[model samples]
Target: MSEIHGSYDMGPSVLSPENVAPKTAEVQDLERILRGEISAVEAYKQVLEKYSTYENANSLRRILVEHEKAVDFWKKQLRSQESFVEESSGPWGTVVETFVGAAKLFGDGPTLRALKEGEEHGLNEYQDLIENGNVNFESESFIKTICLDQQRLHIATLDSLIMMNKV
Candidate 1:
């Protein structure tokens, strides 16, 4: 075998080891958000099933669809980056489930209020991510779009709560 020559100068590193740590952290953050969306979807379904005959049941179903869409979008984004999306929502999910269970005891109005609060919490998380300025351009764009959708969902939930109060 021939002896090696001078040190090979590789071109610029696209994803150097130093660059990876921040990216990995960002991915983990996104995965956390994705898990939250998954829990939200499940929570909405549980509420829908619990109050199938409630006057605003159909509206709840529509909101569930929106949450499902958010889940799908997050999944697509994570997959695009070859990131592993966490399947479970972790401890916070358990807390959400417990809260939802308690809210059910109070009937449809309380359930809707709980859901509205959840959406607001999710919106705040996204906003925080955007404010942190650590995400890549693609992730930033996706988060902004998600934030807008979440804002709409929050408003819709508020409207539903108002109407429920009227009834």
Candidate 2:
């Protein structure tokens, strides 16, 4: 765990009963982020099914792959820590699907808008963890650098795609 924490006491209090019941706050937080990434993957799949032949399918697929990579990265890390990763995206995934599903009825532009909003929500989640999460040094660095960067790129990509889709 020292490698994960990057040389430290590993934040002893992070494992206190109050801080850890089913799991430590840090692990719980990571799982929550993981679920969001999973939800992103699902939502993209839904959109891709509806937009399979649309001009932006390639862009959506690229973003979907990025989301999938995040999910895989977190799943492996959590498994290595002996933590259980949620098999489903959980409730949050359902909510994302609902929104995107409805948007699909409105048209491709609306669907892209919904996805952009979802990506923004995901970006906000990463920012919140950076500012408020009790994760170790390495985890924080990972979120601040890689995670946040990816979120920004995803959102920007969605924004560009949305504009292209607009008349």
Candidate 3:
């Protein structure tokens, strides 16, 4: 009901940095996962472009869309609480970009494997977030359902794609 700035203020406040809710480990982890989703979208786009002619392009694109949705969900949460959304994917994103870029040289097999690896990393991250008992993030159901489902689906899809390519 309130304006974005009226309800949430991410700017430097009169209070010290430590007092900010956004600095909490849970928010930090949420932002990290959000950034990872952004990075996943980027990687998917790159791999999709490289393999546009492949028969399973739509499946790959579906996974990309799922990642994008996760990014949007996190961004909305940050907007409500943290009052800021990350534009860049941050440190791990840089690593993903570099890994995918290099994998392109080796062709479809490596690229698909690279994408699967990324999904595995994401799955592990989500699990870690849920396992952190110190912070019982309310959206754990969403993490388990949508987030984990998409990651596992991507992994399985990529696995099938990888095996298909081998033939």
- Estimate every model's Cα lDDT from 0 to 1: 0.74, 0.83, 0.82
Kindly report which residue stretches of model 2 are placed more than 4 angstroms away from their true locations once superposed: 1-21
Tens-digit lDDT track for model 3 on 96-132?
9999999998988998899999999999999898898
Residue ranges of candidate 1 with Cα displaced over 4 Å: 1-23
Give residue 85's lDDT in candidate 3 (0 to 100).
65
Query: lDDT of model 1 at residue 109?
Result: 68
Which candidate number has the best TM-score? 3
Task: Identify the candidate with maximal lDDT.
Answer: 2
Worst 10 residues of 2 by lDDT: 12-21
Question: Model 3: which ten-residue window has the lowest total lDDT?
Answer: 13-22
lDDT for each residue of candidate 1 in 35-82, tens digit (9 for 90 to 100): 888878888888877777867677677777877887887777776776
In Å, residue 44's CA in model 2 sits off its true spot by 0.2
What are the per-residue Cα lDDT tens digits for candidate 2 across 1-167? Answer: 34464566655533233433478777888899899999999999998997888766888898899899889888776766667667689999999999999999998788989998988998898898888856777778877878889888888888887778841
Candidate order, TM-score descending: 3, 2, 1
